[model samples]
Target: MTNVREAALDVIEKINKNQAYSNLLLNETINKHKLIRKDIGLLTEIVYGTIQRQKTLDFYLDDFLTNRKKIQPWVISLLHLSLYQMIYLDRVPDRAVIHEAVEIAKKRGHKGITGMVNGVLRNVQRKGLKDFSSISDSAERVSIEKSHPLWLVKRWIEQFGLAETEAMCEENLQAPYVTARVNTMKTTVEQVLHELSEAGLDVIKGDLSEDAIKVIQGHLIETDVYKSGEVTIQDESSMLVARALDVESGQAILDACAAPGGKTTHIAERLQGEGYVQSLDLHEHKIKLIKKQAERLGLTNVEAMALDSRLVTDKFEENSFDRVLVDAPCTGFGVLRRKPDIKWSKKPEDVERITSVQWGILDSQASLVKPGGKLVYSTCTIEEAENQEIVAAFLKDHPEFSMDNTMIERLPNGVEPYVDGGELQLLPHYFGTDGFYIATLIKDS
Candidate 1:
């Protein structure tokens, strides 16, 4: 039997040294090992836990290394995995982790390096962790508490005040809940819940959206209901965007930036094959993703296209669509639970650059809505510049459009009053969903 710890070490090395995404590398390695269900769980935990707490692990390592010579990336990765098991997995004894690390080091490195590895880890075990209070910087404290990069922590502190920033950081550390939207067109929520329960799955009703079901302790992907396209995995916050659009049957809808077709499929399902849903994204590959989803959901009204929404006026007549959804891309600070590495990878300036692009897309797509038609602007981000400020600025420039408060009434249940001048903002910690923002606008006749 291959050592599951060794496999995790290999995947961690690829993530840190080779600069690969943690999820992608984990999936690839798991498939390659052909591991049993239990080993697969262990391998996933070790890899993700090590990467997620890398900053804390490195801080612990500082106590052990005397000279702190530049260690090779793979050795550092191996040490991280060993330390993670020693500290986090109480079932795995410390001596066993040390033994495995020493053995792996000896096999992969020279005798002296193996000795160094053993000595350093043992010293850390003895010295315990260093306190961050000594640093005396608020940003540094936030970084240690949240395991976030100092720059990001500093930015949040400046933008959201210390207490709220700390809360946001703490929220990001929790494991994300598995939320899925029932395809009402294919099966009712009651039918899906009954079928899932019969299959020995543990699921609970979602708090915010009636159509959403939160998976408590089962892999819904393995269930026939999910595989057969009776449900689609989407966040409760995301499910609100489609419902907020208040789509009607026999209307012509344009989903700008639609890829992987989550919202597009939801719109089609709501329309019940009465409306024509044109799903357009910039990439040809993404067009296939939309097509595949439509095929799976048995949706006939969605037409997938590979065209830029920003240049829609050149291709389609003005006032062409009854409703247009511009789910513009932004720095995804909202879904950090799924993409932890983004905390380390993103720069502060990235926000401004991405917001600029979002503005252009919003401006271009707003023209596609017919006079008296509705337009929805949404993003999976909590940043004000990407959410409220974007919509506020758009309304100032366009006199023909006005806010629609009635759209909020159509949202899923328990969604608090996040509406401000027709926009809705959903914070992750508050909504138990990814941070999301939505605004509905109607063109004045």
Candidate 2:
């Protein structure tokens, strides 16, 4: 208990003071301390669960802080972490949570602070979060209840309406399943499933993609299929990007924002070892990542280099490739389930900034497509300004490119519910997959 509490506090402090990412810090700190598996699970549960529910926990704690007591940051963090366990973790006994929190306070604080910590948690145990009906404004109340920023909630209400916004926020707090794409270039999904089953791994076929498999449990990279480049751990929604491009054998393709090479490798796999795929990225280090993935997958069709997609016209000739894919950078609000901290880390202004950047990359890469070629612009974001609005604005200026009506036919069957005409915004709550925005465009000859 002591080690778990201490480790969680260390991660919380770093995330607060240094702005360290919660996932990276948790993995690093846990390995650094060499904590056992049980303690590791406890520490991870408390850290993510507390951070995910920080706002709601603080809202509940506000009632117990009756005298306007100015508690230290560490003390507040302790209370928040402990209250998360009490409110959300039903398997955890309330008495044990309060006792562990009080104990943590004593070890980390003085006698006076320890007493206050014990008092606050006990009062919380006695009375749960009172009616949020007092929060008058609908968006504000939903924000607190779902542990999301009020500004974000307000923005979402305007875009998605009340019901869907609430559902999306609630889904962000749930654990996401692990999905991996089988390298269909090397082996079929059926053969991979058979191999995984033989290896004693619990796995199942993905919902949408014929090539993607969802891991029910266990680390995939440790298994022989992954080590041998038979499977790559990628989200189901992400697998749709390469398919959206609909690349064929001997077709030249450009992956404008290829990095860490999930989609780039998928594109290469789709090519079936013919033609060329110039995987361009902004950084040399990330380009190396693409090269590494290409090598691991035994793909020779990919060529990775540090070429900024925003400067695509500057580096490459106009109408150079048969197809271009811009998986644009975004505020990443859509992937909150995989990265809950993004909700707190991002600001409203960031949406405008990234939208501008998305437009710039789109503008530059639009010229890279050959006449009669296709350009697929996609983002793992659900925001209107970044997703639909960005493409709408671009198409307003560039009449040469029109929405690919065939996009609807290209999507896997169960994806029709989320598909909007030719473009689709995969909602987290609706599809049970990572939120992704994929729009296919064809340049008129």
Candidate 3:
């Protein structure tokens, strides 16, 4: 348990210093420590919970700490981890939490530091934390309560209204479900669910896409079902991209910014070993990931290459493909449930830089879509500037393309009402899914 707390603190400290993503760092720490299954759950809970509620935890710690500037960053991180378990996790008693924290401080710091750690936690346990509800400013209150940045909270309040922004912020703190896309080329959703159940895992059907399955209990990736390519782990909202492309047999497709190939492979599966899909990424190593998924799923039609999509015109002529997908790079605000570290790592200024990259990718790839063909722009972000504004800017500059309403017909039942003016902005509160945005466009014939 002490080792588990220490492991969680190690991940949190690195994340604070901008060393690595929380998801990656947590996995690395777990494997490095060779933690068992039970400890793995506790470690994950502490790491994610601490990061998810970081701003709120800091608000609580501010009441107890006399001089926060003098405290070491790692020591502050330790407090965050300890306070998280004390406030959020009911299974661990107050005594056990403080004992382990003090033990960690004793090993890592001097005598005075250990005493400080002991005194602060014991005081917090006795006096209890102050209620953040008393905060008068809506954005500040929501930011502190939900553990999101104050800037983000204010931005969202302006876009989504105060009520919806608060709901979305609340939703971000909850853990996301493990969703997988069933490989139709290899099997069906019913078959994968059966296989998962037979393996003693609790599973359910996804609400967004028919191809998705939600694993309620146990590791779906570790099972033979996933390794054998019967399923690929993906978010339900992300699985919507391939369906929006409306692929048919033998249609040429281009997946710009394809990597780690979740959607690229889903598009290939829809083609059913018939159509050719040209998948491109800037990095050679990421292209390898696409190829691996393609090979694993026995997809023969996907041709992945190590080339920047912005330079795509250099290799392919205009109007060369039947459909194109620009899963543009943006500040990933939507999937905060899965990657809470994104909340702290991404700055508001990143929106302008990423939107420029997104527009560049769209501009470079738009000419590749065949006349009368479809092109879909999607992102794992809720920012209007990144999603709807980029599409508006594209349509304003290029008159040949118009919003395609036909794609909405193909979407799953519950999601169409959210589509306004042929674009869908899925907030985290929408369906307990990631905050995503999608807009489908048609090239004028």
lDDT (C-alpha, whole model) for all candidates: 0.84, 0.88, 0.91
**Colliding pairs, model 3:** none
Task: List all candidate RMSDs to the true structure.
Answer: 2.0, 1.7, 1.0
Q: Which numbered prediction scores highest in TM-score against the true structure?
A: 3
Better of 2 and 3 by TM-score: 3
Q: TM-score of each candidate?
A: 0.94, 0.95, 0.98
Which lDDT value does model 1 have at 248? 91
lDDT of 2 by residue, 330-411 (tens): 9888888878778888899999999999999998888889999999999999998998999998899999999997887777
Q: Write the number of the candidate with greater TM-score, choosing between 1 and 3.
A: 3
Tens digits of per-residue lDDT for model 1 on 231-285? 9999888998888888999999999989879999999999988978999999999
| lDDT at position 185, candidate 2 | 83
lDDT of 3 by residue, 45-107 (tens): 999999999999999999899999999999999989999999999999989999999999999
What are the runs in model 1 whose C-alpha is more than 4 Å off?
none
Better of 1 and 3 by lDDT: 3
lDDT for model 1: 0.84
Return the lDDT, model 3, position 318.
90
